[model samples]
Target: MKDLLTTTSSIIVILFCCCVLFLGDDADQHLSEPDSEMITARNHKKFLKARHPLAKTTLFRRVQSVRLKDGVLMFVTADQNGLKEHFFIIRDKNVILVKKDAGDMPPDSIKFDADGHGGIQVTIPNTFELDPLQDLLSCRN
Candidate 1:
């Protein structure tokens, strides 16, 4: 019985060592480098912190999408009651207040287009609001 127990313990130790050797490098790399999704989430959290320092009732409900063309970010905020939706655009690291839209209509999609003068236009569906792409970036969340 003693010999058998020793053999089993040695086998288990060998298996564990093998696993660690084979998986060690990949595990270290994964831990050291964060993926794009993690980076994006971190950036969004930072944006919220910087934009809405004193916000309690109003906070970001959804980050619709991030524009790939110009790396622009779109965020939607809702009041505590969720009765109003506030749209915001982040470009060049500046957060711009786009519009305060009604919450009755659900947002379908967002369209992005070039404005010919080195700017991009954003259009939210189900609304007739113009693209406030050039709006001031002075909103306090």
Candidate 2:
């Protein structure tokens, strides 16, 4: 009977140690994960202080935005004075600068036409596609 009790106690202690070790490893991994607010090279450009200081140019401000299909957002930002609009898009949580104005400048050349089902259909003339895996892995400006 004493031997059986000792074996049972040993098993219980081993199981407890395994649980604590597993939980400790999991908590450490969670702590090591990158924080969303932490600034990185990809997102550092969006912050005001990191931008280049120009004599006439101030900060770029978002003047207009259009919601497109599949959780995409088209943004139009202008210089501090709201002149010289720039176009961009946020797709799959990545901000992409529009390389060319495929359509027109006043409307940013990007046509956000209406779909029959009350959703936005975006039309871009040029190739604006990006490889999600490559973007995440590589350093791109």
Candidate 3:
């Protein structure tokens, strides 16, 4: 009985060591989330941290898509009121708050005024300290 117990313990220890050697600590990092989610979260964190000119924007709801073309990023823009179903352009110290019409293409020129859903003008600050990523994550949890 004693010899059998020792053999079983030895096998268990060997299996554990093999698992630790093969898996490593990084396995725990991806134990819950997949690789793509981790990459997306990091990118989202970088974008929301005042990379754009308009740091005053608020995240009303979760938007689906964000694309970049010709050095410009097209994504949903939100404010204190609600979310917009149109695409807002962010590029080169400017945010073109243009909305997509019911037709195929977006409007050529939106009203460039801050009174409504046009756009806002501001100087890009040296640093952006807000953590909109954490705020949005907390909402999910």
Candidate 4:
């Protein structure tokens, strides 16, 4: 009976030690991750401050173009003061608009037709000819 009791106590202690060791390792791994993330954020802030003094300055930047499939659906190269920098589209059926900070300054040869609401649409030839160089199928901007 004494031998049995000794064996049981040894097994219990072994299991308790294993659990403590594994839990300690997991805790250490998790503890290092947050510290690295905090260090990275701190370093990026220091780099930005040293490189660009006016990085935090605020300035007005207005939307000027809404394009769909290489087609200039809307064009506003320049906006007048007090005239809205952004216009809301009430309806854009079958249209995916892209916002461009550079505005609609396409080559002069690509003519635009009035689509109303300060927007222009690219006119395609009625013959249905495709430009071999132009591939506007991708959904990504």
Candidate 5:
């Protein structure tokens, strides 16, 4: 009878240790950020800092062109303002939206044109507007 109790206690102790090790409370802290939010935040940061400051003036000139590749659907507008041009190349959807800043100029217009070869060109005017991309993304196929 003592042998049986000892064996049962050992098994219970082992099980408890396994559970504590494998299902520890520390697991939650290590989780990575969601993909969507990460993408949005990264893109937002790029817009504020202007990854290529010269590219803004040179690449965003009037009638300038911006191309987007597959899996890359969002972009900042050429305008110095904080507007972002989000595109859904899968469905040929495009929209203009503005980002917030303490001291930023407003953008005026956003234009979207598609190339026959799965490419898109976006143009932004001098003023900012609401996130038109949201409405475009919500539409059903």
Candidate 6:
């Protein structure tokens, strides 16, 4: 009985050591590297330019507000000429321009004004129309 107990204990210890050696602290390192596929999948400008005829004219607009609502991300923006734009992320990689009657207007938001040479300014409600990117990095739980 003693010999059998010792043999089983030794086997278990060896298996644990092998697992520790094989798995060698790579989980954290893998997470630290920025995922290229995710970045490429999120290339919003490329997707927008492909869909819209006036995409070239609108792509230059700066980001305005990025907020999260009930796990969904909302992005609000303003163009160089003070046009307001609203965008939202429905899934991991999908972003869509929201319609005017979609929901309530975003709260007091900041946007870049071209007249001020890209200086940030407070935007008025529903003035000029534009689309923006959701601030996913800052929206972490």
- Among these predictions, the greatest lDDT belongs to 2
Sequence-dependent TM-score of model 3? 0.20
- Tell me the TM-score of each prediction against the true structure: 0.22, 0.28, 0.20, 0.30, 0.26, 0.22
Error of 3 at 93 (Å): 0.4
- Per-prediction CA RMSD (Å): 14.2, 18.8, 17.8, 17.3, 15.5, 17.7
TM-score winner between 1 and 2, please give it. 2
Using TM-score as the measure, the top candidate is 4
Error of 6 at 65 (Å): 59
- Greater lDDT among 3 and 5 belongs to 5
Cα-lDDT of candidate 3: 0.45
Q: What is the Cα-based TM-score of model 5?
A: 0.26
> What lDDT tens digits, residue by residue, belong to model 3 across residues 93-129?
4353333331422222223334233456322111222
Cα-based lDDT at residue 100, candidate 4: 27
Instruction: Report residue 55 deviation for candidate 3 (angstroms).
Output: 7.2
- Local accuracy of candidate 2 as per-residue lDDT tens digits, 1-141: 999999999999999999999999999888877654677787776864442333121222333443233333444545566645343344443233333445443333454443233333344434344333354345333
lDDT of 1 by residue, 19-136 (tens): 9998998898888775534537649776555533332222233334322223334444434555443333454643323344536334544444443334444444434344445333
Please give the CA lDDT of all the candidate structures. 0.47, 0.48, 0.45, 0.44, 0.47, 0.47
lDDT, residue 103, candidate 5: 35
In candidate 1, stretches whose alpha carbon ends up further than 4 angstroms from where it belongs are: 35-141
Off by over 4 Å in 5: 25-30, 34-37, 41-43, 46-141
Clashing pairs in 5: 106-127, 107-126, 107-127, 107-128, 108-125, 108-126, 108-127, 109-125
Worst 10 residues of 1 by lDDT: 51-60
Candidate 5, residues 1-141, lDDT tens digits: the string is 999999999999999999998877567555544433543664887656543423321133232323334433344555567455655454544423233441322232334444433344545443434343564455465
lDDT of 4 by residue, 1-141 (tens): 999999999999999999999999999999998766643664887654453332232122333433333332332334465434323232433332322232334321223334333443343222223341343454234
> For residues 1-108, what per-residue lDDT tens digits would candidate 6 score against the true structure?
999999999999999998887677676567767653443665866654553432221222345655555445456557667756564334453333332332233334
